[model samples]
Target chain A: MEVLRLQQQLIELTNSLFQEGFLDDQFTQLQMLQDANNPDFIQEVVTLFAEDSERILAELTKTLETEPIDFKRIDAYVHQFKGSSSSIGAQRVKAVCVDFRAYAETENREGCCQALQQIKQEFFLIKSKLEALLQLEQQILAAGGSLPVME
Target chain B: MENVDGDESQPGREETGNLQNLLCGKKILVVDDNRVNRIVAAGALKKYGAHVECADSGKAAIAKLEPPHTFDACFMDIQMPEMDGFEATCNIRKLEEIAKESGKIWHVPILAMTADVIQATYDECVWCKMDGYVSQPIEEEQLYKAVSQVLSRT
Candidate 1:
């Protein structure tokens, strides 16, 4: 009964993420790629994404604070951020990055700063959500129940 | 599951080309400065039964191609730090030219694996003499198609 409840929660949470546009089809592709031989593939990729995003975010913060801010450098960092976020299907974060890149291209400091904050917000939001989801997955597995497949 | 060659079902072989078979026994090199990107690409290629090797940077990739290069194909990221894909491809081409001078004629096809599929990006890829490109996030069908296309040429 507990396993069933966990499964239901997992499914519902996953549906909400997609419905709210927190994730995209790319996440589904990642899930599909995970198999018996590589059961932790998604977990590994998510961990990597989170770590990489933190590094890029820190870089963006530092670079933005420099004198005579180099928009080119800002653009490059955002581009890297965008790639990693999109790779993990962090749709909201990736969306902010698209706007962030445009602001950087135009050398708009105010616009870039605002976008940076926006990106950071989205990143943290998704990070917590993903962490919750992964934790729930672990709980289900530990309870001897298989993960619920997302429809 | 062990059908690495993906040639087990010969009946539907012609009609439906097995996706896994496309990369069977092929060796692929994936170069990306980003750790996550490299892991993602390598994982996907391994699923398709391709022996995969990785280089964290363009310089590392160049080092791997020292001599008697055995990689069947390479997927290179475009916007890496230090040395980008275009520069790496240029350097690799120079090495190929040197190898050609020594009476070895070989060109290992390089596919630009990038997130930006813009017109300018494609233009630059061509200008760098790249065979083709695959988009980032590494979709399976696209990866297979690009790899098969390049492998067929050589």
Candidate 2:
């Protein structure tokens, strides 16, 4: 019964994440990659995403702080961030990165800064939601239950 | 409604099993500057039963391939700091030529792993003698398909 309860919780949380636009089908792809042999697949990828995102965000912040801002370098960093976010299916963060790149390309300092803030806001929101989802998965596993299939 | 015995019925299990069979015991190298990229690529390949080794940069990859040339295949990441994938692939081809001249026939297949899938980007990989290309955010099926395609050629 504990397994069932945890499974239902995972279902609801995942649904909410999708409904809220924090994730997309790519997240489902990531989940599909997990199995008994690689039970930690989603967690590992998410953790990597979290670490990589943080580092990229810090670099972006520093790069934007300098005079005569190097738009090319900023674009490169944003490109990397966009790729990582898209890879992990962080939909909103990736979306903001798209806008961020446009600002970087035009060398618009004000626009770029605003886009960076949006990216941060989206990243943190999705990161916490993903962490919660993973925690629920752990709870399910601890209860001797497998993760319920999404969709 | 569906049985979840953690068996073949699982969504990707059968495909994963097939990939493991195709890649099992194959020695492969993953070269990428990003630790996260390396980990993700290595993890996926390892899950499919490939014996995976990694190099943090193109130069390190070249060092690993010198003389011995033991790796069955390689996944080379583009856009590294010093030597990008194109340069690295070119160097690897040079090494192959030298090995051939020395009466040692060695042709290690290399696949470019890039986030950029532009037509010109792929053409550049082929120009540098890379066997094929795999797009980034590496999916399991795509990785397996690329590996199989490259291996099939040789």
lDDT of 2 at A134: 92
On residues B1-154, what C-alpha lDDT tens digit does candidate 2 reach at each position?
0111122223366667778777788899999887767766776678667899999999999988775667989998887778988888888889888888989877788888877677327578778988888876676656667777767554
Best by DockQ: 1
By TM-score, the best candidate is 1
Residues B6-117 of candidate 1 have per-residue lDDT tens digits of 1231223332255566676888899998887888888777776788899989999888775578988888998898999899998988888888989988688889988867
Pick out the ten consecutive residues of candidate 2 chain A with the lowest summed lDDT. A24-33
DockQ of each: 0.31, 0.26
Q: Evaluate all candidate structures by whole-model CA lDDT and list the values in order.
A: 0.82, 0.81
Looking at model 2, give its docking quality level. acceptable
DockQ of candidate 1 (2 decimals): 0.31
Query: Each prediction's Cα RMSD?
Result: 5.8, 5.2
True contacts kept of each: 0.50, 0.22
- lDDT for B64 (candidate 2): 86
Q: Give the distance in Å from residue B2's predicted Cα in candidate 1 to where it truly belongs.
A: 37
Isolated chain B TM-score per model: 0.83, 0.85
